[model samples]
Target: MSSNRKTLWQIFRAPLLLGLLSLTGLIGALVGDGLFDLISWATLGSALAVIAWYWAKPTV
Candidate 1:
């Protein structure tokens, strides 16, 4: 991979990957007619919040 692409992936990889996984699970749950909307939302929301927090204040 190009350095620029690698750098971009390094910056966004975790959140993007986790978010995609969460979205997939959320869609699966919804399509399966599961009554776990709140749980899914909370899980995804918390993941997003953590990602935002880390982006805002990254500590080495």
Candidate 2:
């Protein structure tokens, strides 16, 4: 496999994306709308995907 280098932001993208999505979901939840529920579920699923990606990554 080729050596791929990741910058600091790239390495930290998942939690950052999760945080932004969660914040958006929270704000939507506060507004009380069906759209927010979808956003929340999407955020949750994205979180799970991120977790799975890291869990299944190859170890050096």
Candidates in order, TM-scores: namely 0.43, 0.58
Candidate with the greatest lDDT versus the true structure: 2
lDDT of 1 by residue, 1-60 (tens): 254546677889987877886886577568655456666776667777877988999565
Q: Residue pairs in steric clash, candidate 2?
A: none
Candidate 2 lDDT by residue in tens digits, 1-60: 458998899878877889898787667767777887788778767877878988999877
The C-alpha RMSD of each candidate to the native structure, in angstroms, is 5.2, 3.0
lDDT, residue 48, candidate 2: 77
Worst 10-residue stretch by lDDT in candidate 2?
Answer: 24-33
